[model samples]
Target: KLVVNPEKIKSLKDVKGKKIATPQLGNTQDVAFLNWISEQGWKVDAESGKGDVSVVRTDNKITPDAYKSGSIDGAWVPEPTASKLVSEGAKVLLDEADLWPDKKFVITNVIVRQDFLKEHPEAVEAVLRASVRTNRWIEDNPEKAKAAANAQLKTDTGKALPSDVLDPAWQSIQVTDDPLAATLDTEADHAVEAGLLEKPDLTGIYDLTPLNKVLKAEGEPEVDDAGLGVE
Candidate 1:
């Protein structure tokens, strides 16, 4: 989501000349934001992150503090962090998902070392099965899943998200097994437009057989790899 300080921005046009943040220079969100800015007829130096707008590459964990300190006026950030900024008086001016068809985009995906996968196909299948089952569980019991997720976060990170930040962030997410591969391809194009990447072959970038097998066994529709899967 693109969140802004309500006091500073009244609308998207107001974002011009404002200081905005992304997780890292040349990262996914940064590329997307740069592409959007270019489409708006704005010019920016992608590497230095300077021009019509200031693209501060701040880590998500400290984004809320950056916002509070007025180091940034807004951020193109992922959840919990987005909600945290909202808690600090930021307004969600745009949901990036809405920019894509059907309001769907890739937030995360599983990746494994090719050698490890080849040596342990069974283990790969098991991980995919677990992921599929967890997505289904989240769909079936959202509240319970949220609680479990918070508990796990606390266990792993030593702190849990507060309900005020957790609830809305959880509600905004759509857990799925598909991976939305086409969106990844599109994001690569965004990177190219942002001058962060060159056009290159992405053929055979995915090995979705394990994922499809897990889905088939679970009686769920299989997913495609946007023609980038191993033939």
Candidate 2:
């Protein structure tokens, strides 16, 4: 999502010439923002993050502070970070999801080392089964899931998310079993077009058989690997 101080910007056009932060240089969010900027007929150096718009590579942990300090006008950030900025008086200017088809895109991925996967196929399938069930559980009981997530967060970070942040943040997420492989391929294309990445083969990058097996057992529809699955 793209969040800005309401006092400073009112519309997408106002984003021109503003210092916008992305989570990291050449990351998924950075590539998407760059692609959007290009679509606006604007120019920005992909590597240095300078031009008509300043793409500041700020860490999510410090982005709200950067905005509060007036160092950045807005941020194209992921969940909790976006919600946290909103709590500090930032208004959502645009949702990145709106730009994609059906407002769906991949935000996270689970990767397993090929060697480990080959040796521990059963373990891999077990993990996928657990993940599928957990996603469904989260969807079925959102409030309980939120509380449980906050509890885990507290254990890790020494504090739980405040309702102001947690509520909106939780609302923005979509827990899905699909890997959204096609969108990931599109993201790579966007990065290449923005000069942040080179075109490269992505064949055999996915192996969704184990996931599909779990989904089938759970009485769910199977997912495709966007033709990038291992042969």
Candidate 3:
């Protein structure tokens, strides 16, 4: 579907002056869309320095409802919720996975307090260790992955998620605790390439030593990069 969803969304020009629903202004998706609107040469506000696309501020869960009631044109929603909305009657005008060909998207990520990492270094190691195994498990077991995901999200949604939503999300993701630096080396590259940042000077962003030490102790097999997302 990455190949199917073109980066140049057709008829977004039709949306000039129309409300573009998003989770939050200046959050990643908002930034991406604003950049795109600028690229399209539409009128942007001088004072706010934002795009011509009217930003419809809403929570992620409420966005589909906003769309249904004709309050917003479309939303920057995460899967399986995004695709679920389409199934329930809202149209999927732009699926980002389909929009950016040969590129992948990052969905959920784990964030820990800096103090937590500093104080409980061993705990961090355990988490990464469990994550390594979990990552491997997800790669090896798609059915279980879907079941776990559906259980986590679908019960909240009150319906079975179409596999189309879960399949792509699962395939495009990995579960791991690779040192943030190693992960961000690739992430920074993608982020910069996407014009999200000028450059990511990863000075205080991550530390890899604790995780490396854990891997050493575990005699962990070097995981292949093929299935796991983004190196």
Candidate 4:
């Protein structure tokens, strides 16, 4: 989520020459923001984060405070940091999902070592089954699932988000078993455009067969790997 203080910044163009905070330089949100800057024909050093806009590398723990203290004009951060900022009178200027096709992109992905997958294919299949089932349950019962997730978050972090912040943030995310392979490729391209990464040859980077098998057995459609899957 990209949020701005409406009093300080009314639009994306207003971000130029302003101080903006990202969790860290070269992190996913940082890369995405840098890429957007490149698209805008603005200049910024990917490593130093110095350019048209002052890209401050701030921790998520302090980003909301930074905004409240008027140190940063805005932030490009993930939830619940984004939600936390919203609670402090920030306006959501953009949701990164809306920038992509189908309003879907990969925020999280499941990975396993090649050796592990090769040795324990059945284990992988079982995990995928559980993942698919969990996604289905979440979709079928969003409010209950949200509460369950908040409970787990509270257990881990010792605090649960208030309803005002949690509701909108939860609504923005779409949980699914699909890895959205094409979006991963696009993100890599974004990193390259932002000068944070060399163009990577990502062929065979995905092995969705186990997930697809689970979906098929459940009478669901298989997801495409965007030509980046193993043969």
TM-score of each predicted structure versus truth:
0.97, 0.98, 0.67, 0.97
The sequence of per-residue lDDT tens digits that candidate 4 reaches over residues 1-231 is: 889999989988998998889999888899889988888899988888899988999999999999999999999999888988999999999888778888888879999999999999999999889999999999999999999999998999999889988998898878988899999999999998888889999999999888899999988899999999998
- The C-alpha stretches of model 2 lying farther than 4 A from their native spots are none
lDDT of 1 at 225: 97
Candidate 1 deviation (Cα RMSD): 1.0
| Model 3: per-residue Cα lDDT at residue 78 | 59
Find the 10 residues in a row with the least total lDDT in model 3.
Answer: 1-10
Compared with the true structure, model 3 gives a TM-score of 0.67
Residue 31 of model 4: what lDDT? 87
* Candidate closest to the true structure, highest TM-score: 2
Q: What is the C-alpha lDDT profile of model 2 across 1-231, one tens digit per residue?
A: 999988888999999889999999988899999999999999999999999999999999999999999999999999899999999999999999999999998878888999988999999999999999999999999999999999999999999999999999999999999999999899999999999788968889999988999999999999999988999
By TM-score, the candidates rank as: 2, 1, 4, 3
CA lDDT scores, all candidates in order: 0.92, 0.94, 0.56, 0.91
Off by over 4 Å in 1: none
Runs in model 3 deviating more than 4 A are: 1-10, 43-51, 89-102, 105-107, 154-202, 214-231
Ranking, lDDT, top scorer first: 2, 1, 4, 3
